[model samples]
Every structure is written in structure tokens, then in C-alpha cells.
Target: MSKLTGTTLAALAVTVLSALPAAAAPEHHGDDGLNWSACQGQVDPRQQCASVTVPLDYNDPDGQQITLAISRIPAAESGLRHGVLLTVPGGPGGSGLNLPSSAAKRLPPSVRDRFDLVGFDPRGAGRSTPVSCGLDHADLAMVNLRPWPAADGSIDGNIATERRIAETCARNGGPVLRSISSANEARDIDRIRQALGERRLSAWATSYGTYPGAVYATMFPRHTDRIVLDSNDDPDPSRVGRGWLAAFDQGAEDRFPDFAKWASAPDNPDRVADTPEQVRPLFLDLAARLDHSPLPWPGANPAELNGNVLRETMLESLYADARFPDLARLMLAGLGRRPLPAPVLPPEQALQNTTAVSVATLCNDVSWPSDPTGYAEDVAADRAAHPLTAGLPVNVMPCAFWPFKPAEPPVRVTDRGPANVLLAQNLRDPATPYRGALKLRAAFGDRARMVTFDSGGHDAYLANGNACGDAAVTDFLVTGRRPAEDVFCPAD
Candidate 1:
């Protein structure tokens, strides 16, 4: 749900450390260990970790306190230092803590040596005072947590599921849940910029982070430096989070071709069909069969491989090219051509944090239609139009039943910011999809010029490896030069 793809999740995890409480304001124990030491291990050596205290809620700046875990990779050469560059990770749940180092490696030498890359775990995520609904392990599973309806298109099960999830989160999530909106995250980012002693900060924000970044640029226009928003989401304020959830239908449709081609390739070990076109119907048939009769998946949270669960996994796997095989293998297993073991899920702690933050941000961003009838109507219409998604995108979520209303209205992304923003998007992103990116682009208007990549899966920039698209982004980041007009990079 949300932009909580695995890459986004992993990035958020590293940043999660930034949200942790500060060690008793360290004694003047010296610049001995303070000199920008190399970060240890997989956590970027270029990045130096630190903490900054921000209000739990920005509206009440003098209220309760929370600490944000912040990291910085200084400009390589002081003589070339230009300004600070902030890396905003995706997932309202995702963390940006280690992004400074991660993003530093992606920058061209020109940009890397000119700016200190900064990253932080937003409040209610990762290292920042983490929030959990204390949900049971089963409830934390992706399929269940996302509120996918029963196989036969029944809203009854979904409604019940939403109520249970919403109630549990309300009871156990504490006050932190109330403060987990994207608006709050944007305010927190501004606070981090102030803490960094910067007048303006260049930023690279992706997926869900794009919305907050755009909001930040709008809220504090004078404080924004060059900005890059990758894998952008629809910035429709009225339907903010709902638009993202609804977008999965289009996203899955956009990305299925990549999976189809892979599954149909003659050389592939898990080839499931003779042609790309055949792959879709074959998958649909398999899911429908499983819907009526689920296969026992011992040790799995749901205890069975139901149709909706399989579909959900398929959607998740489509986020990256590396995950294609997982979906193919499952397809083979479901076809009884090559039985395989069940997949291992993430640790309980990780799942809880992910679910908690995802739900909180989505529900707190805007009000979801509470009527079961409304969801039923939308699901029916969506099912007919996009069967691959199985009406899941339009179905009810915990937000529909959430007891708490959003404290603030969703921030509308506008053209009121500096014209320093650039957006990079994959044409076939399963999570953020191109159609939605177009909406965000339209919202930003002249404020952003997008570089659309002819590629499949989610995320763009360094992770996607499309040289044309990557070069466009790198050029913008380094030179603060965006294309005078929108550009498209054909698939290589």
C-alpha cells in the first residue's frame, strides 16, 4: 500500500535510525569522535549520522518533542561546496536516514562534490519515534493489511476487515498515529532544514515523498533549492491518498506486459505460456481457481494461498525487474507444473512499522468514503475494467473505517514554487504508474519538467538504470538545468 515497495521500505529502514531518541545530550566529550567519521558497514561510509529534535506536531511547535534521525554526507571538496541537498525517501512510511550516502553515490562528481546530501527518517517512521498499532502478525501481512476483498467480490469481508484493523490501530497506535499525516512530514522536513542551518536545500524526493517535497517547496518556496521528484504520485488534493490506492489498477495493467514477456520467454526457467498475450488470461484463470479453492500454504500468515493473496504478491513482485522470477515461480506453482515452497515474510517488527505508518499516512491524509455501498459500487466497476487487479484497488481499506479524522486537510501541490523541480518516471511503474505522474506534472505545471522513461516496473533514477533518463536527472541535479520542455527517453 502507498509507495511502500521493498526498495522504498529498505531505504526507510535505514532512515528509521534517525527517528530514535537522542542519547543524553552528549557531554562536551569532544571533536575526537565527532570529526565526520566514515559510516560503518553497508550503511554508507560517506554518511555521518546525527539527531535533530522536532515537534511531535508542527502546528503546536512548542508542544511535545520528538527526535528525527538525520544523516549527512558533506560535499567532497569545500572549495566546490554549493549548498545542501536533501534526500526524501518514499513511503510516507519510508525512511531517508541513509539516503545521503546512498544518493551521494548516485550523484555525478560535480553534484557530489558541491553539496552536502542530507536525509532523515520522518516522524512516526523508522528511527523517529516509531509507531505501531501492535497488530498481530497475521494482521500485519501485506495482503490483509491492504484490505483486499474476498475472491468473489464481496465487500462484506472487506468491511469487517477494515473495521477490525481500524479499531486495533486506534486502540494501540497511540497519539503518534494522529501526527503521521504527510502535511506533518512536510513540516518536519522544513524543521530539519532549519536544524541543518541551511537557507535553502536542494532535494531528491521519490514516490510518496514527492508529495511532501512538493508541499515543502510550496510552503517554504524561498527555502527550496533544485528539487528532483522521482516516481511521482498523483497530487490530487481532494483524493490525495485515495488516488494512490486507486492508481494500482492502472499500475498493474501498465506493468503486466513486462511480466508477460518474461513469463513467455522460451529461455526462462519458469516460463508459463507460449506468448505474452496468453500470460494474462492464464494468470486470471489460475487466480480464479485459487479463489474458489485455495491451496494450503503451511506456516503462512493466512494459512492458505488464496486468490487475492496470490494477486497481491504478484503486484508486489512487479515493483522491480529482480522480482519477476518470484511471480513466475508462483505462477508455475499455481499451475501445478512446478511446486515450490512458501515465501518467507519480513520480520514482525518491520511489518508492524510498515503497516502502521502506511495506514496512518493514508487515513490521516484525507477522509475515505465510509459507505460500504460506495466501495461496493466502485469495486464492481473497477473489477469489470481491470480484472488483473481484481477490484482490489477500489476496495475498502482501513481508512474507510478509521475512527480518527485527519487533523489537517491534504496539501494541494501547486505551481506556486520555484521552477527548479524535475520529475523522473518509468512509463510502466506498477506502483506510481505514468498516468498518475502526469497528474503530478500537471499540478506542478511550469514548476516541473518530467523525463519519462520507456521502461517497466517502479522507481526511476539510478535504481532503474536507464541511461537516458538517469543522465537527464543527473544533469538536472548537478547543473540545476531542466529541459525547457517535457522529454521522453525511449527504451534502450
Candidate 2:
């Protein structure tokens, strides 16, 4: 899922009779007394905001209450108004509070004018009754959040780190933390639809949001209209979040070539190597050296650049082709070479919320392999196969040591939904690779037609800059016209 830094880049199991009406009933807003004014400040003047209170635990609707921050930008041209179009932001942790504005900008004017653009911060994120694991600043760093093995592929440090983080969250995170699974998020989305009084919602869900979107369509088929899943993740129920965590290895391998080419281009101002082939080894050696001796990075959260820290930054930078320079500059700086200073990290509160929600959703979505030996072997094998990432993708995370089991099973995505879904993917997305997307596509089966872009980056619609891919998606969102079959958009 795309973090808040922006530019770059970029599940469920249950049916419970919460306050929400049955899936077969036409959606209607009851006397929930939702006040659109509460959503102010986060919404544009053209958009109205509302707070929909949902049960923190769907199984016990009357037990405790949680609010979902929801906003809607009504059709700009009322004469052509069609229906509501929801923009589901990525990130099992990413907040969709600001997505209506961002997505409205990317949409074609015709589509933008016809459909009301909606966005919401999923439970445990942003203004929607946020959850916090109360992790210290140092523990919230991306390097710490994403497990990375030691320089020698030893799992000792990683295992200890996972245990510590897990212990912290388990102690600090309240019952809300246990409710932050993908299945719950999907259920919350359906509840939002009911609150909006919409029989069906046209949606554009990206990254991790794709999983919940798929689940929503499966659980409530008739409620989806013109669904668009961008930068999709694999819907392997058996693996769930573990599968996504492991996919980074393949994703990095798929996307590194793009970075290599950019970094080695002779004419580029930030070129780091003489040729693409040299970029990989140069990066590996630099990371290894940093692993042994980290440099002091004053402004960074952890206040230093270790090998794993650099590796984490590399993974984030690869999300967007435009961010390659950020990684290259960091690498150059660590190599006893002068480069630009690193960007400032978000405020501590922001980081805490983002990190907390990310971990809660990921760890709560599925049970991870608890066997330390399994992680050790996988990390070692991954290190050998994809050295650029240095086995971090397969390394142990807090999920491996999480104290609580998933409250519910993962939703099995199947071909039981309306055939209104269209999936768009980049062939080389560093975050959600094509190989994983194939699983999601297969889960949807005859219900979806995929438009694969032969491009590089995390996002695939307007963000990818592929005219072929963009046109296909835009047409579908606007006119409901889908390709007769799966299609590929060649590199431009």
C-alpha cells in the first residue's frame, strides 16, 4: 500500500448481522443521525463529509461504537450526474480521507462531472477512531516495521525485533487493534454504502484496498458497480498478508531493472553507475557496508542509516520511477559521497498512526508462520535469489510474533460477484507485482478483465503515464465499457 509521502506510490471472511441491513436490501440511510459537518476540514467545499458510526466488533453491534470518516465530492456538473463513485485508498493502512480530491483530479472531466467522488478513512486510520500500538519513535521507523535480516543473513536480530514490537503492540493496542483486520474493513465499507443510501457503488480501490474491494464484491455482489482495482495484491486466502509480505521479493526483482536503467543513464544528473549491470552490485555493496557501519542521519526517525534502513528506503523509492533519485542520493551519501540531505519524516503522531494501523491490519488479517526456522530459511533463500532487497521481504515481522490470532478468517475471493470489475496492473510494480496480481485476477475469474500495462511503477492508472492503460480504465469508469477479454498495454 502507498504511504502518505505520496507521489510515488502507491480479504475477509465473514458475514455478521451488525447494524447493517441484509445485502439483498436496497441501501437506505436510517436514523443514524450522521452529521456531514463532522467531516469538515478534511473535505473540499464541493464535498460533504459525514461520520458513520459502526460497531468496533461486527459480531457485537451493540457493544462498542467506532466512527468511519467519510467524505463525498458531489458531481461537479449536476446535469450529468450519474451515481456515487467511491475511491478506496490503498494501504491496509493508507487513509482515504484525502483521496476524493486526489482521485477527482485524475479522473476525466466527463466522468468527474457525472459521478460523485467519495473517500473514507478505513477504521483504525486517520480520523476514523484511529488505533495506536504506542510504539516508540525508533520502533516506528520503516526499517524496524519491515523486518530485515542482519548483514550475514542471521535471523537473531530480526527475531528479537519482531518479538519486542509484537510485545509492545500487544500491551498497548486495545480491543480496537484486534478489530483492524481486512475482513472488518470490507464490512465497514459495506456499512458505509448503507449509510449513503446507495443501492450500488462504483469503486476504484488501489493496492491493499483491492483485497477488501474484492471481498466486498464477493460478499455483496449486487452492490458493486463498475469496479476498478489498481495495483492489486494477491488474494491467496491461505497466505493473505503473508503472501503480500513475501511478494516484495519478486516485486523488487521485477522493478529494480527500471531503477538500474535510470541510475546508470549517462545523461542523467543523478546517475550512479556507468551501466545498468553495475548499479545492482554497487547498491548491494553499499548496503552491505552500511550494515557493518551505519552513517549518522540526523533528521531520520531512527537517526541513522543502517543496511536494513537503506534497504527499506530502497523498497519505498522503487514504488515510483520518480523516486529513484531519492534512493540513489541516499546511497551516494552513504558511500562517502556528498548528496542532498534526506527528506524530513512526518510528525511523530502521523507516523505513529500510520505505523500502528499498518501493523494492526497486516498482523490481524492472517496468522503468520510462527516457526523461526521457517523464516530463517526463507530469508536466506530470498537473500540469495534477490540480493538487492537482501531478504527483507521474507524476513520475520511482528505478525510472526503477534499475541492474538485473527478474530475472523480471511474472505475467500471467488467468481461469485457481478462481472463489473476491471483490474489494471503494471508489469513491474515494485509494491504489488504482476505475479501476485495474477492470483487476484484468477480469484475474480470470469468476473474481471485485466488490463496489464508493460510499464514500471506501483500504480497503473493515470499515475503510470501509460496512455493505453489509462484509456482502458477511464473508459470503463466513465462508460462501463470493458475490454472483451484481458488485454496488454505495451511499453510506451
Candidate 3:
């Protein structure tokens, strides 16, 4: 997701149905200064909230401190508690303080009984000491966040926009902003671990969260108990966040067919075409028409639905099958078959915070090419190669003009850790495609095992109803039992 995952990050998880008995779990263990109190918002009653203080800059451990908002639901049967099961939400921006309640609902009660479900607002995110770039409201648009190239594939606009955004962030974002990075997030996870009084912690991380999850596993090998990375990202230390953005090209190609198949079903009220083969060309034609003549869409951020907006919608819709109808509705409205759906927008404050962290993480993770000419060429090439994404995946981002360099090199995930990692991946994920997961798998080498699912969308284990994938990951988390070899889970 580059945490480009919009506001739907929380919905990116599958259900669990593990047949393993609770006997394989570990003994109960936990303690901390964390005081149990009901969360203030709409979270479940079982969830208790607390705060953990850590140095804003790890290098200066005793310097200035910041508070991280954390939450958790105790194991249903504390007698069976195995340890903490930390939930790492996607987005450098997504808030996880409220996620424990929701995640507990998705996890099998047997697993829940053996582990305390924990979540946190990563530094510079929600309820933690937050950071904002004071960006203009218009900058919060999905098309801008995704860095879609112009219809002609010119990146002049992208370069200028990125420069402006970078300048704005540097002007208002302070030292705390500079402290946010994947390495530091890994360090912060360790802090969370110590605060929980757990010698080892299991983790379930998806989308952008998988990067930090892997980093934590690599950096704190002895402290990690079990890790389940769903919808993974490329562990390419060289390109870093830039590689994640570029992945959308292949990701869309991998995922669009599922949407096509769904949209072309004869019984579908939102059928866009009679055959899957026709769906792609029809979509391309519709997007091309919109590129020239955008339809007025009242109340949307830009106040109009243009080709790029539709394309952004397509990328989001492909993250899950449930979102397929959103793209279908937009396509139908673009063709004048129906009125446009009401505009959906994240709350303004949340958008501002998320956009800031996303930009900071991507820019702070690595350096990006500053030359517009190079980006333009790349965009044009990508557009020709992957028409569905229209070169947006390779377009320049705010990182191109960021003022600061990475504080530390991106963490290289090595194959030196314990064999406690289980990866669940959908072959056709649009955000973190299966190809990227393959890279992560290679990086972990003998330290990990993978369960591939013949499914589409971002989340796999619980999302596609793939019982095989779900059981594999669940068994690992619950029983610490993984397949002796890499496994394949056919779609249900």
C-alpha cells in the first residue's frame, strides 16, 4: 500500500477457521505498567487502552519522549494465554488503537483464548503524538496521493506538485516527523514487546505493515514468536518504497481479471459486458473517454470524476472483491447507464494525517529520482505496458522532492531468523501482489514458509473464503505448526 491503501486498511483481513486444538499453545505470560481502561470511541467493550512512552529518536534514547497510544483485549481464557498477538495495521498512517476489538472478532476464539490481541497507533499516526504537514485540502485527493500521471504521460505536473508537497511538509513537519521510518517502527515494536512483558510476540501484519513486520522479525529474531504476513511488499532494499508504488502495474494486471469475471456474469445487475474478454477493452475505452471529458460528480474532493479518479477507484476496488461494485458503478455512470454514486471521503483530519505519514514514510525510506524527464519516460513506458494502471504506478511521488534523506538504510530482511514465519498471499493481490510476496519469501529463505492462494484481492487468508490458506496461517499462529514445505491453497 505504500500505505496507499486509502481508509479501507482495517477491512483488509480474512476470517479464521483452525481445526487445531488449543493444546499446542504456550503458557500464559505478561505484565506491564499498562492500566486497563475502556477505549473512548466506538471500539468493543472488551478492548482496554493504555499509553507507552518511548524516545522520539532511538539514537538519543533518553532525549525527548513521545507517547504511543496502545490497546488490547485480554485472552478470553487467560489460563490458555500463549502470549501477545500484536496486530500491525497497514499504512504508515492507519490507526490500530481500535483494531484489537475488530481483530478479536475475526480470529477464532480458540486462537483468541491463547493470545492477547494488541494494537497501537504507530508514531505520527492516530492517537499517538501525531504529525501533520498542514497540506492544502485539495492535496488529500486519492489521485494526488497515488501520483497518477497526466493523460499524455507528462510528469511536469507531478514534479511541481511533489515539490510543493515536500516544501509544505518540511516547513511544518518538525523533528518528530523526521523520526518516523520503518527501522524505527521495528524498534518501536520491540518497545511494545517489552511493555507487554512478553519475551516473544507473534504478529499479524498486512499490506504496508508487512515491511515493518519483516524488519522486526529480522532485527529482533529472538523476540519474535510467530509472524503472519498477509498481502506482502517487495523487500527490495534498493528501491524501497518506490518499488511498492511501481508494483501496481503488475498488480492490476494480476487482479483485474477477477473483477472482469465478476462484472461480466449474466445475472449481475451491474454487468458491464457479456464476456470477460470484452470487459478490459470496454473499461479502457470508458477510461479513455473520461480522460477527455470528465463527468461532473457533485461533492467529490475534486468535484468531478475524471479518468485518473476512475483509475484510482479501480486500484482501490481491486484490493477486495467486495469493492468491485464500486468500480462497476462508476463505469456504469460514466457510460450514462445510471447516476453516479454518492462521493465517499475519509474525514478531513484523518486524511491529512494519513497523507502526511504516507508521504513521510515513502520519502524518508529512500531517495527518489528528481528528474522529471526520467519520470516522464518511465510513466509513458508503464502506460503502454499496463494500460489498466495508465503509468500511475511508475509516476513520481512527493519523495522526488523531499528535503530530507533517509535517516538509516532500509532494513535488509535476511534468512537468519527462526523458522517462525508463515506468509499468506493471494496470487492476484492488487496492492501487494503475489510477485512481491515471492521476493519476501526469497529474502526469508529457510526462515519462512509460504501458503499461496489461487485467489484475487489484497487480503487472502480470511477474505476469499480460502479455507486452506486460512487454516495454514491459523494453525501456525495457534499451534506453531507450519507445513514442512511451501504449500498452495486453491481458491474455495
Best by TM-score: 3
For candidate 1, the per-residue lDDT at 442 reads: 91
Per-model TM against the reference: 0.91, 0.92, 0.95
Top-down TM-score ranking: 3, 2, 1
Instruction: Compose the digit string of candidate 1's lDDT tens values, residues 292-407.
Output: 98888888778787888789879988999898888888878887888756568778886688778888888887888888999999999999999988887888888888888777
> RMSD to the native, candidate 1?
6.9
lDDT per prediction?
A: 0.78, 0.79, 0.83
Q: Is candidate 2 or candidate 3 better by TM-score?
A: 3
Which residue pairs clash in candidate 3?
Answer: 1-4, 14-462, 14-463, 15-462
Candidate 1: lDDT of 255? 93
Give residue 31's error in model 3 in angstroms.
3.2
For residues 1-492, could you state the per-residue lDDT of candidate 3 as single tens digits? 344631101011122222233233433344587787888988889999999999998779999999899999988996787888999988868888987888877888878988989999998999999999998878888887778888777777777777888899988889888777777787889999888888778899988889889888878777778789988888888887778888889999999999999999999999999999999999889888898999998899889989998898998898888889999999999999989999988899888887788777888877788887888888888889999999988888888788898876666777775778889899998888888899999998877899999999887767788888888888888888778999998867
Tens digit of per-residue lDDT, candidate 2, span 9-45: 0033333322222122233344435576534564456
> How accurate locally is residue 444 in candidate 3, as Cα lDDT from 0 to 100?
89
Question: Listing every candidate in turn, what is its Cα RMSD in Å to the true structure after a full C-alpha superposition?
Answer: 6.9, 4.6, 5.0
Reference-based lDDT, residue 473, model 2: 88
Q: So what's the TM-score on candidate 1?
A: 0.91
